[model samples]
Target: MKKYIQSYLGLHLIFLIIAMILFLPLLLNGELVTWRDSQFHIARFHELIMAQQNGHFFPDIIKYSGTNSWGYGLNFFYPTYLFYPLIFLWRLTKLPVTSILIFDIIVVYFALWSNFAIVYKITSKIKLAFTFALTYVLTAAIGNAILDNVAVVRIAYMTQYASNIVILLAPVVVLSFYNIIFLHDNRTWLRAAIYSSFAVMLSIPTTLGIVLTVLCMVVVAYFKRQLSINNMNQLLRSVLLTLGLSAAFVFPFIEQRLANNWANLPNNPDLFGANFSTVLMRIFNLSNVLSLLIIGLTALLIFYKKFNYVYKILGLSYIVALLFLYSNLFPWYLFNRELSGALQMTYRWHFMPAILGSLFVAFAVTDLMKIKQKMLPIVSVMLIYLSFNGMMLNTVAKIAMLMVLIMQRTILLHLTRIILKPIHCLA
Candidate 1:
């Protein structure tokens, strides 16, 4: 009990330090207030608060062009979905929107911490799990998304942040789903259903990614004869429950959007003449040292025969599919022009894959470390090469430095243990 309390306190201290480090710059520079994305969300929250005060439920029509439109126009306030809890706080206490903004940032960090705890549960390595979680939060995808949001002042695009929050929950959702499908744990199925439902509610694109990943897992399970009839039944039940819960929110939204001719409607063609090459370039352009680390580590794992060939192949296939989706391929291809038109610019759709790549790297790194061989130098060189890439260059550098610091600490701890052994015997 005492050890548990000490560990809890230690984690809290670590989180506090990390939060301060990430938050200090925004606080000191006063950029937090002026950040364009921040202003837009704050504005949307105020609008919602005002509507609530006037005895209206949440406003269906968010003014995008200084006028409220019902169907066709973008609802810029959708990103504020998670902030529904904070809405109550605003009503009860009448706190300034800025205060809520600060609070939300803290919430995001806490969400991140929770995500770290989940990863640790799976990996059973606090350091590696925390490293993976930190990488996810501090990656260039997040930094760039925030920077763009601040620069663009488009609240509608806050979907990026929403997607990020969903990503933080993904490990837990995936693990739960795996347990339910493979182990047939009834309680696990219920929990997984709830988590999956929440994930689907958060972002459709992310939900689609999760579904695709599960499909891939299912195929692998089938080929390996790892799935039995009972397991399949439990998996189906979990998925059905998740889908049913999600349909409550999803159906109405989809129907409304469809009726109103939503932007990026299905069956659209490539209006911008975008080809596979352009999409590929976008993928390469977004690639960073961390991304390279994931790729390299994944390759090394396969080469060393650490993972089964099928699992390794599936991992690689998933990465490729992610890249394809990010690129102007089938489904995303159809909507590329429409989304670009709505946003008034072309942003790399590859951002999610880049973020997911970190997890692949984490899994690979954990596997590699377990093998008794010289792998550090190979990873180090790859990191150096990746750091040379120009995208989110500074953040990538920080990540690389953090990894190095961690490795150095491990080495020092080992050496200290070795040096102390002889002295203890002599004493």
Candidate 2:
């Protein structure tokens, strides 16, 4: 255990430094960075606190806009389970707005850790695991979607926490299936069922995601012939049990929504959403150069000989899934009109790419270690150009940050050697 601790101490140190560089410096600058929905979310937090004060420990609905005559509440359509614990903590401690900012930061970092766990399960390489985790957090897609100036962004009002929390919980679902389907771990059923229930508690957007992801995994396993009828039966039983476990929220919520159906929502979608790109990109225009790099990297892995066949399939499938969603090839949105309404935006499943794409990138990026050292500079420049093209910085500024990061890592490693060497000598 001591040897194991020493082996990964450097990596943990690097993760801390990286996380600090990304969030701490900007967050500590004493300015709250928020988007349009920030005030609404802050208001929601206050209302939840008020509800707790009124002896309603779990608030079913909160008055919107603070007037009973014009009140609107989202509880029937959305679940706030993800934020309950944090709200309770705030209720007890009475922390300030900075606490909220810190909460967002912690959620994004947890997402990076989640990405790492998923990739590590697939590749089982520590470096690749850390690299993919870092990629998931810092990638322009995730950065734009999840954060604003190091704070989690205001996307879904009170449910902004859902975006990051769901990303963080995604791997647990995948890992659960992998255990039950591939490893045949009997103990994993309890875990799978619980994770499924917790996932459902996250709300409709995530509930849809859970159902889709589980279905996808089941299909993949069926194709691979790794699943028998009994295995499928077991998976279905767990999922059904989750629905039962989730009834406290799900049943009441669904009944309320059905009984009081919004008059504004129509039965027919336009077949294509009004905001086409918004449905897909969610207000962020991904750099074409970056897109190509993502595609190119995925293709390299698809053809790469060293990776497991399963990984290659999974990676390619992820890319294909993105392409379908990004384009109009699939009618999943039109088919699931109610889900589209629940998501309230395009790219409802944006978290999918952030989770699976990291695994794919980890598989592809690890092979770079085998490349000749002389071409390292060229590869480094290419990576910087591809990944950060969306940032809109001048070329020089982009290259400068890349060079600085490289230099900082090098210096940190040298200092780590010096620091640990003295400790080692004493021990």
The top-ranked prediction according to lDDT is 2
Candidate 1, residues 221-300, lDDT tens digits: the string is 78978788888887888888987986756666666766765444232244323467554433333233444455556577
Write down the TM-score for model 2: 0.68
Q: Candidate 2, residues 1-427: lDDT per residue as tens digits?
A: 2233135565455445444444443355534445454665676677777776788766666653352221223654345666776786676667645566556555655555655555455556766666566545544243333322111222112234554455556665766677678766545566668766766776565557656777877788778888887787778788788888888888776666666634322223443343354334422232222233456665654465555675667556665656555555566565555554555443445556555665556556666556523232343345434333222223543454456567768989999999999899999
Alpha carbon lDDT at 278, candidate 2: 37
Residue 346, candidate 1: Cα error in Å is 11
Q: What shift in Å separates residue 95 of candidate 2 from its native position after superposition?
A: 4.0
| Weakest 10 consecutive residues of candidate 2 by summed lDDT | 148-157
Quality of model 1 by C-alpha lDDT: 0.53
Candidate 1 off by > 4 Å: 1-9, 33-40, 63-67, 70-81, 89-97, 121-125, 140-159, 182-188, 219-225, 240-289, 295-319, 328-356, 364-427
Clashing pairs in 1: 36-150, 37-150
